[model samples]
Target chain A: MRLNLRVWRQKNGGSEGAMATYAVDGISPDMSFLEMLDTLNEDLILRGEDPVAFDHDCREGICGACSLVINGDAHGPERTTTCQLHMRSFRDGDTIDVEPWRASAFPVVKDLVVDRSAFDRVIQAGGYITATTGSAPEAHATPVPKADADSAFEHAECIGCGACVAACPNGSAMLFTSAKINHLNVLPQGSPERETRVLDMVAQMDAEGFGGCTLTGECATACPKGIPLPSIAAMNREWLRARRKVKG
Target chain B: MAVSGLIMLGYLVAHVAGNLKVFFGPEEFNAYGHWLRVMGAPVLHHHWALWIVRIVLLAVVVAHAVSAYQLSRRDLKARPTAYVHRRKRASYATRTMRWGGIILGLFIVWHLLDLTTGTLHPGGFEEGKPYQNVVDTFSTWYGNVVYIVAMLALGLHVRHGFWSAAQTLGVGNARRERLLKLLANTLALVLTAGFVSVPVAVMTGVVS
Candidate 1:
């Protein structure tokens, strides 16, 4: 299959960018989207041109590193992340419009590559078990309710893809933050730092210049892992309780 | 309509509670009416204050409308060309919120002018007679009918708006969101019924 690609080209972080067109011929239908791009980059390199730069390490879609907005939808027209998308999804001679994730906090570092370090900063603020680590405790020692454990596991699935932030009109990371908050806050292991966890994570999220959640639910819809919107609501409840506790 | 609409809900509750005093006779009803005028008058008396409140309410209505407008635009931009087949998953009320809000906004402006300013009186109340205005407005069958329908629409608006705003402000859990929805619906039903009954009673000659 032959495809016309309009790929975003930027020299560096500060350079002006534009969509540079290229034609890549003879693509296999079984080739993954990233593999297709890799073929195009190979062609560019052979032609003595700078290869298009995109972020992808483990092309297995679990790393959340392969971030691209294909035809205006985050990750692609399909609900899955970019790495999981295959070339067969597009028809021959199809003009594919590819761009980097657009958000104030996720600035473009190069072509199709965004600096998503803000997410790491937010996670470092609190998304963790802060208790002293020693020998592994017995799993049954805590005896957490089945429901709470289930909910925590559900929230734990978020991969910090930054899609929620890109898709949000306000550029809010509430869904991502809430997932981390609820994941730990629901379990007994995370109880000791519950108040501080919520406070620190939320404060760090805001400090990173992300917008507040408007509850549009676009973040959930765009999320590759389908992280529930209710996670944010749970975070809000926890934040309120924490604030009240601090005040008291 | 957003701010004033909410304010009008508050006003309707107070108004219905005050009108219930009619069962106690003229002195009590009149005193209740007088108390509203006395208290609301100072804040409402100055032309500046009245205009200020109107402006603030207008701002809220505009903000609500503008937000809806931008969302609509993005929805269009997100899908410029229609899909071969599309299925909607949103509830009917959620889907029609933009249209409902537009209709409600237009109705509110007309409502304010008709009742508050006496610009378009559906009821023939002699000038300077607020009590007579209340009675005459409620007495007509058509007038009563419109009021009832408008109140029903207001109820629907509040049913969704209250919880939606809370979600937008990021202040609810699943449990709390459900509770807020129930509270909003209950408040809407109570207030709508309370206001609607007065006109029904007047039109039926149950209260004379």
Candidate 2:
């Protein structure tokens, strides 16, 4: 299916960017969204034109490397990652707009690629559990409740994609930060630093210049992993509880 | 913002209940107004309790407004660029929160001037006769228009504000989401209807 694309193009982080239009023909209906872009890049290379740049690694959707707000919706109209979105979702001759995530915290590095190291810093703040590395311990030694395990796994699905920030009108990273906090904060193994985990992570999140949560639910809607909106409330509960228990 | 907003929401519940006393006629309504000033009676001096409440509400309003201003500024700064292809996102009430809050703040000034201070009252500003003062204010067309519009804005504000406050306070969850939303909607509908009833009664000569 042939498609008209309006892709955001930027030379580097310091330069300004704008949408550049291109018409690509003979696109296969079965091709993934990234492959469709590959077709465009190939054509551009044949003509010695500068090909569009974007972020993508594990094209399998789990790596969270692919970032694109296709047609105003993060990762396109599909709920899955951009790599998983196929060309069949669009009709022939459709004009699709592609842009990088727009958040001050995640500034555009190049065309359709933004700096996401803010997420790394948030994770560094607190996203780990204490464990002995000398030898493997018996699974029975640290018994995790079924409910806690379920909740942890649910939050563990977050891929750090930054779609939440992209979709949030306030560009808040509350969902992403909350997901990381809850992933470890719920488990028995994560009990030791639970208080510091939430406190430090939230502080780091705020220090990163991310906006506060307004409960808009846009972040959860844009999330590919389906992180529930209530996850944020859970994190807030943890933060408040920690604040009361551990006075500054 | 959440704490201040909840304080204001609680005040609104009591305010609406008091406004509903007007349906009972001038005597009961006037007595209720007098009771507000002398609420604590011998325990606290006359108008002292009212003054306390006024001061607390003033502080809450200032806190709420300051936090809202800061939040809005940060929100705008966070998202510096706009999406070229923008689609409407979130519910209508959710999107209008900022503007709705400003409307309520402005309405509070007018409401106090017209009813509490009687400075903006169309007829002679009479003290100790709140029932008649209320009627006089609602007697005019612009009074009813401004009041009804603000009340509608109030309903929308509370509808989103209550649910949002619940979430912000960490009281919201999947199991309680439905219950919280229902409660928010009920409070919004009840408060709007209660306050609007006063102006409607005056316009229709039901209480005049």
Question: Which parts of model 1 are misplaced by more than 4 Å?
Answer: B1-114, B118-160, B166-208
lDDT against the true structure, per candidate, is 0.76, 0.93
lDDT of 2 at A44: 99
lDDT of 1 by residue, A154-224 (tens): 88888898888777656778899999999999998999889999999999987877775545677888899
Candidate 1 lDDT, tens digit per residue, B111-198? 6666678886765645444556667677666667677877777677667666666654456666686788788788878877777777
- Which residue pairs collide, candidate 1? none
Look at candidate 2 and tell me the lDDT of residue B139.
Answer: 89
B172: Cα error in model 1, Å: 4.9
Task: Evaluate fnat for each of the predicted models and list the values in order.
Answer: 0.15, 0.74
Scored against the true structure, residue A5 in model 1 reaches a CA lDDT of 92
Error of 1 at A150 (Å): 1.0
